[model samples]
Target: MPYRHAWLFIVTLICATIFAFWRTYFSILPEAAIGFHIHGLTASLWLLLLLAQSWTPHHGRIGMHRALGRVTFVAVPLFAAGSMAVIHSMAGGTVGGDPFYALWGARLGFIDTLALGALLYAAGMALRHRRNVRLHAGYMLSTALPLISPVFGRVFNRTIPGLIIHGPQDFPVFGLGAQCGNVLAAMIALWLWRRDPRFGRPWAVALGVIAAQIVGFETLAHSAGWNALFLTVGTQPLPVLMAFGALAGVVAVWLGWRLPEARGRPKQDA
Candidate 1:
């Protein structure tokens, strides 16, 4: 597969995040409408990093990957900064329609920050254990985190409208669809981890951690107490987003770990 093929999952994730953003925060501008250039630039650069992470046929391509990795690393902090800047800018200047809009924007900023932190952690692991294939891939997947929220967001956006029309929700289905889908994805991933004999013990633990987080976030969102606490604490939304990203990353890492190495045996752990 082309590198982009693997990255398509990332593309889907971005869409999900956008849909959730539009639904919770503000609506998306028309595809053709010119909007904030800074937002687009920041989002696009983050995506460029995503695309760059895919290794093609070669294991080491210093000429191609190195040059890109340097800038990508530098932009790590910038991506978070620019994303938050655009969001706060949107909340103050562009978002006057719904109170929920502002809240979601605040939420997204926090989520992005957490995602960035996870990415940094994963990248650090890769650097520290440069030669361990499974561990390196695990870290890569973790770093490439935050890509799953968009997938869940898109799923909610695509399905909720129709669900509301058909179901007896009196009102629109609201945030339930997104939350349900998020939990379901986590559950299914856990199921896969449990059933697959190849995943080994480490993956079971990883997947278990992921499921616990899904439960935690869902619990927090539903609990009036947690909602109030998070509201008071003003933690950015990136952690919830990062939670989902890390869940998906754990799945990816599990599979990568289970796959046969080039030598057709298990690869060394980090």
Candidate 2:
């Protein structure tokens, strides 16, 4: 609750969203622009909801948290879908679009997959730690951070081209905003984990996935002929999406089964 920077982060995201709208700051076409805006707004709303729940006194969490959590579960995947659409539409149409596509198109897919994992983890943690007051709250809070991909996508939204961006031409070398977010999340998650080591494991799991995407995206993007391979890989029909969704759902439940039940607490805080 003493995290002033966290409060500031939500505020910063709000302002960035405003600028992104007012000045057409993201340098995208109308359709892609709409997709980004919608996703960004939903992502911001989700984060605000998280902040609201987090700052609320425990006694105050009677039902709002549960309602908000349910809404977030439905909301994030839609955002992920919109992001996928935006990425697909922009593959070679705009400046830096192709390169960024080549560099990180699979990233949206991978992180979207991570969202499913986080959602699964959130569901289990929500139940397993329901009785252990402190651990449940902290773990659930961190788990939610990664559930919505905007934090990563949005980070790169403002960060990639820098403040003085002139169209999308200069997205070369990518950007560090997404990494900044992961590091911040890891640090805070670790700080909270010091209060209980169980928190450390999931934090590590989520953080590890985030770090992996950074390497994974660039690696695939840079590999010769990977662009063509991914382009073909990405050309899935609705049946494919549905099948993968079903398979992913099964995998999520399986992971939910594997997490240890919340049973203990740290003896001291870091």
Q: TM-scores, in order shown?
A: 0.55, 0.62
Per-candidate RMSD vs. true structure? 8.6, 5.5
Per-model CA lDDT versus the true structure: 0.46, 0.51
Return the top candidate by TM-score. 2
Q: List the residue pairs that clash in candidate 2.
A: none
Task: Give the per-residue Cα lDDT of candidate 2 at 13.
Answer: 54
lDDT by residue for model 1 (150-194), tens: 346446545665534232232234345534554555554455445
- State the lDDT of candidate 2 residue by residue for 93-180, as single tens digits: 3224455555455445455555555655664564455445554555455655553234544545555546333455754433455545
- What C-alpha lDDT does candidate 1 achieve relative to the native structure? 0.46
Question: Weakest 10 consecutive residues, lDDT, candidate 1?
Answer: 165-174
lDDT at position 243, candidate 2: 47
Residue 44 in candidate 1, Cα distance off native in Å: 3.2
